[model samples]
Target: MDVFEALYTTRAMRRVKEDPIPDNIIKSMIDSAIRAPSGSNRQNWKFLVVTDKNIREKLSNIYRETWDYYINSFLNSAKDPGASSLKKQNDKDIETIRRISNSASWLAENYHKVPLLVLALSRNDPTGSSIYPAIWNLMLAARGHGIGTCLTTVMSFETEKVFEVLNIPNDKGWTLNATITAGYPLGKWGVAERKPVDDVTYLNTWGNKTNWNLEQPLWNY
Candidate 1:
């Protein structure tokens, strides 16, 4: 697959088919992932590719607990308890938020059935400048092979339970950064819509506009 196509179409696919991804494809994804750059050439990262049904079920329970807590906390802290950060947003933005929330909730409920869960862990990196690039590489590689992935961190809220279930040694200083859920997507892949680059980019200076007028995505395929 073209790199540009992968870049444009690799959106967070939370809902996916239960079909199993081949072991070779998963290996290729991680092989591509480790090729990504790390700080000071110290690749202190571990990718735990989890496929066991029992382990996934345990993690799913913890994930659902964290997800519900997060949502409830956000609702309680917001000015309008029912609005959920949607009080002042326009109709389009509101719809987008709602769609994302629904997808996330669905994933929380069905995490064990997603076929694969990759836990990205790193050590001795205060900022996640090392492991995240590798994770992105893995996701892009999966996209190339028609596998969809969604990177999530809600499990981080209860890392102790996660580490216990996965048998990750807590004394090793490994920080659980993110969990990527992977499977064949149930929906069609398409370019993810986002704000125009020109709208977000500045020319050397902070307030100077680039005036590039990039109103649409550069890669549409």
Candidate 2:
């Protein structure tokens, strides 16, 4: 797929079909991932491609525990007295949040059923900027191969348990950064509406807006 096509269509796809991904495809995705640039060429990233059923179950338990808390918190906040808004708008926001939370909860409950689980790690004293770009590349690479992926971090919060389950060394300078679940998508990737470039980009100063008619053919009207 073209770079622009991948960028535009790589949504957070949580629902996937019950299908097994080929090992070669997984290897291709990871190969693309490691080619991403790292801070000072340190390449301080480690990946655990988890296919073991027992470990996936353990991770699923941790994920669901946190997902429930998150959903409940959002529901509680939406019920607060201070959350006044245009009724329709407020209702839409609440419903959207609820739907997303439901999807996350479902994924947590059935994590072990997914074709692949990837645990990404970074150095404890990371440069703080390089990891995300590399992960983004991984997501794009997966998208190109018709695989859906959800980048989640709930498992990272229970770092010690993850280390124990994965047998990661304590002195390896590693810290769990994220977990990504991948499988064949159940539906087409949807387009995410984004703010116009003019609304976000500034000319030379922070607040100065620039006007231009320049347009890219890839995103042509």
lDDT of 2 at 206: 96
lDDT of 1 at 123: 97
Per-candidate TM vs. native? Answer: 0.92, 0.83
Clashing pairs in 2: none
Model 2: per-residue Cα lDDT over 15-93, one tens digit each: 8876878889889888888988887877888888987778878777777887777667668777876755532237778
Cα misplacement distance, residue 78 of candidate 2 (Å): 5.8
Clashes of each: 0, 0
Report lDDT (Cα) of residue 77, candidate 2: 71
lDDT of 1 by residue, 36-133 (tens): 99999799999999999999899999999999898666544443545655544555765676678898999999998999999999999999779989
Ten residues in sequence with the least summed lDDT for candidate 2: 212-221
